[model samples]
Target: MRLDGARVLVAGATGVLGGALTAELAGRGARPALAGRDPARLARAAEAHPGAPTAVFDAYDPASCARAVHDAAAALGGLDAVVTAFGTVAFGRAAEVGDEVAEHLSAVNALAPAAFLRAALTVMGPGSVIAAFTGVVAEHPQAGMADYSASKAALSAWLRAVRREARGSGIRVLEARPGHLETGFADRPVAGTAPPLPPGGDPRRVVAALADAMEADAELLRTAPDGTPVVERRAR
Candidate 1:
């Protein structure tokens, strides 16, 4: 799982966290294929690292997810790592949240990543890694973000099961539960308005932590609110 010269595909490359990750991966000497819904943004992200490939796909669409993975793998010749940073947050009280918002959140946060991973495994081989950036809200629910929390929780559960199932295959699965980062993610809620909240951790620090975990083949990497390293769990 060495970042140097690793063939990686990063979904949601246009988003704040994903952008940081893509840049960091490039800086670490990894060949990254940037994928996202916006072709323009994906192109821009790829421009940061000359010769990097770009793929366009809607995260909520299973077919698109599969196609994106296939295209990225083809572009890279083979994939050593696939990182899913695609996510949307919805803020609302559980009781007042509409069904549409809940469904959208689930589709983007849970179902989309599942689809991407499934497709990625088809092309990925042993020694490859699949990492998902699921925030701390997945493990600890937060008020006003019930739907968002539930969606991430579902993804976390799926990742745990997949990790157990993939144990014998030599393919690593990592789940990162980083605390809030100053990526402006909270301000871009897909549904309800965001309430006032404290500034988050440094995005660069969070990306570096994830890169370190991938290099060490860790199972879980958790960071504190201030981007301080908290814990790195290895597969037992």
Candidate 2:
């Protein structure tokens, strides 16, 4: 899964983490096709890359997810890797969280990644990779963010199942459970107020760690709060 000259599609490419990832990919010699719901932001991100393609897609819509993957593959000539950095978070007690916010979190954080992974697999083959930026909350839940935590937990479970299914197929599935990063993610909650959280990891460092893991075809990449590589478990 060497990124050099690899054709990669980065969904949610306009976000804080996504933007950093796209830049890192380009620097590593990979061709990255940026995809997001906001056309203007996507355009801006694409412009920065100078000839990098962009696609607009609603993460909640299955058709749009599939189409975005298709467009990215077409734009890049082929798909060697796909990184789904799209997600939304809502902060509230489980009982206090409204159904609308809960549903949106499920759609964006869980189902969207599933849709993107399915679509990417359609265009990818042996030696290809699919990675998602899930969080440590998915594994260790905390108070006031049950809905957000559950959504990521669902994605983690699905990725584990998909990884088992894709075994021996040369398609690597990576789940990156990075600790909180100071990427203004807490400030952008879809609903409710985020509690004061501990200092977060560095977005750039997390992206670099993920890039290295993908190149080595590692399976699980867990990072510390400062974006240091804490654990890396390769497939047996």
Candidate 3:
């Protein structure tokens, strides 16, 4: 879909990837409404875009997730696109992670984004788009990050099913599966310590490519072996 003058809501806009995406969208002439958990951070994020709307929602609360989408769509007059770029992670063996931590991961990483996107569907129409960020781990499960991988995988499956359902309606669903990025996300794990990891990819470049994919109405944004972002016109 064309982004020029498009009304887009970016949930988790206070996060690194989300913030970058919001800026990229705005730069491309799309109007972005920011949404995140913290009111202060949401306000600060909104400052960058003078008139961008802001909404607050808790990841664990499905109603709030739906509320955020409707609120942003209302403020934007109607949403042309919506994207989710926030989640929590836990690093540990499958058996070592506590039940609560595992539950949190499930809620934030999978259920929350689905909640937001499901709500987005109600307000969006044909030619509109909805996207969510799922890491490469979703497709390639990793050790010491079992729960995190599973959560992301759940989200990936959710998007795949939704894509099939929305096909006839002409609403595009994008799943961004970029590899590890230099966003310091690993440093702030909700539980356990991050194992030794290779250097991460450039976040700015990833977000730029994501914007391009959205404009092209592509279905997937993945990372090539060389760490370059690749937009796939088909979802597989």
- Find the 10 residues in a row with the least total lDDT in model 2: 227-236
- Deviation in Å, model 1, residue 215 alpha carbon: 0.3
Q: What are the RMSD figures for all models against the true structure?
A: 1.4, 1.4, 0.7
**TM-scores, each model vs. reference:** 0.96, 0.97, 0.99
TM-score of 1: 0.96
Best by lDDT: 3
- Cα lDDT computed for each candidate against the true fold: 0.87, 0.88, 0.94
lDDT by residue (19-76, candidate 1, tens digit) is: 8998898889999998899888788777787888888888667999889889888888
The reply for model 1, stretches above 4 Å from the true place, is none
Tens-digit per-residue lDDT, 35-148, candidate 2:
999998899888878888788988668889888889888888889999999898899889999999999999999998899899888889999999998888889987998989
Q: Put down candidate 3 lDDT per residue, 15-35, tens digits, no spaces.
A: 999999999999999999999
- Output the worst ten-in-a-row residue range by lDDT, candidate 1: 227-236
